[model samples]
Target: MSDVTVPPAPEGLPYVSVVVPVHNDTARLRLCLQALAAQDYPADRFEVWVVDNNSDDDPRPALPEDERFQLLRERRRGSYAARNRALPHARGEVFAFTDSDCLPHPDWLSSGVRALLREPRPDAVGGAIRIFFDHGTVPTSGPEHFEAINEFRQRKYVEEWSFAATANLFVDAPVLSRLGGFDATLQSGGDLDFGTRLGRAGGRLIYDDDTVVDHPARSTWRELGRKTVRVANGIADRSAHLGRRDALARAVNEGSGAVTIWLKVWRRNEPAPRRAVEKVRYAAAFAYVRLLRTGVHLGRFTRGR
Candidate 1:
């Protein structure tokens, strides 16, 4: 947690293009668009591109009528593809990314732009993501608690893994153009792959806690399980280029790691009786998702063989 004082953005701040990829999540997209519309950043300096990623329920009708917002359609199924489709039309010097389900803080754009313009500026910046339950709701389910604890570790992704989730990421336009955008083939882990590629290309990616977004936590066991499966499939996809032996070894390592995490969770201290019960539920949910992920990867390995 570096304590760097960011100066206030100048009146003539560099133009920023905010890109959001949406599928069938029109409800959340509306909220996301509303937040973007209300950003504290100058409306004249920032533009929003909402790329609808082939949703059966069209999101265009819900888009704001203001000139600052543009609705684009990407017939491609994946989010990365949708983003790529919108990239060519972006007019800003700096590009920011967030999912349709995420609500950016009022100062998100200002904070990100200010950080990018700071001395010894970073090539790309990853922002913070905080998980919140649905509107007018509290965390009442095991999956919700599990998500509350495990969702989008953005800081760790930036500092430890040298990557950032697209849920709250920013990159210079030229750098993004040089990198040729994300791998449209990857349904998941594309953000990690893109960040890794950027770093390997001598680009610096730093974590900024000031730029924040709120993501809705998974509310049910089924949603959590489905997301786990998608993650496992993404891991498998990434390993497709690896030797079979190495892929199997990686799967084994991940499966064992899950068990280790479960054990650690079991040993964690729970101060209150209610918290103890919630802890047990969270552990159970984690164990299930982990096992599900492992099984999916193993299946992928076998199918490849």
Candidate 2:
């Protein structure tokens, strides 16, 4: 397939619009753009939009000079907010979302479009995310890795997921508009919140392994810990909006999972006792977040007045 050239959008919207939010990371951004440009999907059937979220290093020059591709600028710091801004400008039946850090397979867009066009017309579709790590890095493992392992193990849940990751997810434009786009306040779990709302509203979400992306898990243990904290914050922020009964159930499940992780850490054989200690510390950090749901609920109750 020839590189997808930017052409004037036809008289009507196309089948798919690939929307990406980019900030900094010019190198990875360039790679992402190039991969999109090389997509095997029919040029006219799909479009690409990159919302540059106030990045100091611009990534336009690296992309093809085709007009079919749009490089817009938004000063917002939040990825979901940037996505909201771009949605109004999109002209496609389906909205496909992915992150700038991910590199999609050539058939990704084609596969996603096909999945949505399935007999019943799935309301949403998600592709698998395979993690790649830097070579020669210390072979040490951390709590975050274990959590990510859980996520990987749960990838099958995507076929029937109430939550979806924006990194490799797609949705029908009308349904997305009805949901009011992505939630702006969430720093990390906005995708999950969006998917949950859609699913609860009778939308169908399907997982397609054929459409895949390469996700590089860069950053050290400290960075991973910080990320876990941000994820916990997102959970807290979205708890009330998730409905009271659901929120309570989720809190209980998270608490149980945390305990299970700690027990596993204690029982596992470790060459050094410090490894066990570190796991306990990380597990506690996550457990404390399980209890933070009370604060989130209190805030919601006070705001209801």
Candidate lDDT (C-alpha), each: 0.84, 0.70
Candidate 1 lDDT tens digits, 1-305: 01222233476687888999998999999999999999998877888899989898989877888988998898877899998887888887889999999999999999998878777989899999998886455566778877777779999899999999999999998899999999998888899899889989999999999999999899888889888888878887887778567567767876776676556665637321146677677777777887887787677678764
Off by over 4 Å in 1: 1-10, 135-138, 254-262, 269-274
TM per model?
0.90, 0.74
Q: Give lDDT tens digits, candidate 2, residues 1-46.
A: 1133335445533467788898887789778878888898877777
Top model number, TM-score: 1
- Number of the predicted model whose lDDT against the real structure is largest: 1
> How well does model 1 score by local distance difference test?
0.84
